[model samples]
Target: MAGTFYRVQCADCENEQVVFGKASTTVSCAVCGTTLARPTGGNASIEHEIVETVESR
Candidate 1:
């Protein structure tokens, strides 16, 4: 399966992970052995930009 790299911190375990693509639905924290949050797929990248319009009175 295709996957991507992610860096996340465990809520219960408070451990940081550098997941490399195709992460499991439930991953155990290596430090405190806590369940981590997993992606539900269908996620897309988001970008934002601002445009300014000037008017003279």
Candidate 2:
């Protein structure tokens, strides 16, 4: 299966980050150190709002 990338904005600090859609571990914000997404076996459980779907090259 191919992996997907997401552009998410942090709820606490308004920081933007790119995360893997099928992440195996919890993802955090780089600026604020807040929880952004958690692994959910399939797609990651995102805590922040998804700004856009990033296209991989």
Candidate 3:
């Protein structure tokens, strides 16, 4: 199956960004530079609020 993606809202700046569910590296907020997601070797550890889930086809 295709990997999933998540729309996360930054807690500090409320910036909405699309992040891979299995991101290999750390993901930061686009506007605020806050840590939004962290690599966990599997699904990324989301640090902010999850706005939506994106499915790959």
Candidate 4:
């Protein structure tokens, strides 16, 4: 199976970052300490708007 990546923009700071779709841990914004995604049983739950889909290897 292929892993999915997402380019998400932080709502608080508008910081953009790439995150794994099936992340096992919480993801936060680099610029600001805002929560971006949370680990779920399946794909991660995104807290911010997704800007684009990123290709991962």
Candidate 5:
């Protein structure tokens, strides 16, 4: 089984950090020294796909 992970960004330093471990936990950023909110489950991958929709008026 794979460990859980989360995507968190620093509020002060504007840094992106990823936490890989257990669920319902918190992780800290290594760069700006800030704590971030981690997800409940899944891999440590933060990459997400964006879908854009255009509507004609």
Candidate 6:
């Protein structure tokens, strides 16, 4: 199954970026290099603030 995308804001820099819900690798913030999400078998463990949930159209 396909996973959704999330618009996440970094806690340290407030930089907004897209992250995969089912990411297999660690996802980091673009501007601050902060940990945004991590792999957790299924849905990623999001650490930053999730501003929006993107649905595939």
- Evaluated with TM-score, which candidate comes out highest? 6
- Report the lDDT tens digits of candidate 1 across residue range 1-57: 554555656665555665543444555568887655444564322111112212212
lDDT (10s digit) by residue, model 2, range 1-57: 688899999999898999999899999899999999999998899988999999653
Question: How far off is residue 5 in model 5, in Å?
Answer: 1.4
For each candidate in the order shown, give its overall lDDT on alpha carbons.
0.47, 0.92, 0.89, 0.92, 0.46, 0.90
Where does model 1 exceed 4 Å of error? 37-57
My TM-score estimates for the predictions, one after another, are 0.45, 0.90, 0.90, 0.90, 0.42, 0.91
Deviation of model 3 at 20, angstroms: 0.3
Q: Candidate 6 residues 1-57, lDDT tens each?
A: 777998999989889999989999999888878899999999899998999987753
**RMSD (Å) per prediction:** 13.5, 1.7, 1.5, 1.5, 10.3, 1.4
Poorest 10 consecutive residues of model 1 by lDDT? 44-53
lDDT of 6: 0.90
TM-score of 1: 0.45
- Candidate 4: tens digits of C-alpha lDDT, residues 1-57: 778999999999888999999988999899988999999989999989999998876
Q: Which candidate's lDDT is highest?
A: 4
* lDDT of candidate 2 at residue 15, scale 0 to 100: 87
Q: What's the ranking of the predictions by lDDT, best on top?
A: 4, 2, 6, 3, 1, 5
Candidate 3 global lDDT: 0.89
Worst 10 residues of 2 by lDDT: 48-57
State the lDDT at 53 in candidate 5: 17
Clashes (backbone N, CA, C under 3 Å), per candidate, total 1, 0, 0, 0, 0, 0
Model 3 is weakest, by summed lDDT over 10 consecutive residues, at 48-57
- The pairs that clash in candidate 4 are none
| Residue-level lDDT for 45 in candidate 2 | 97
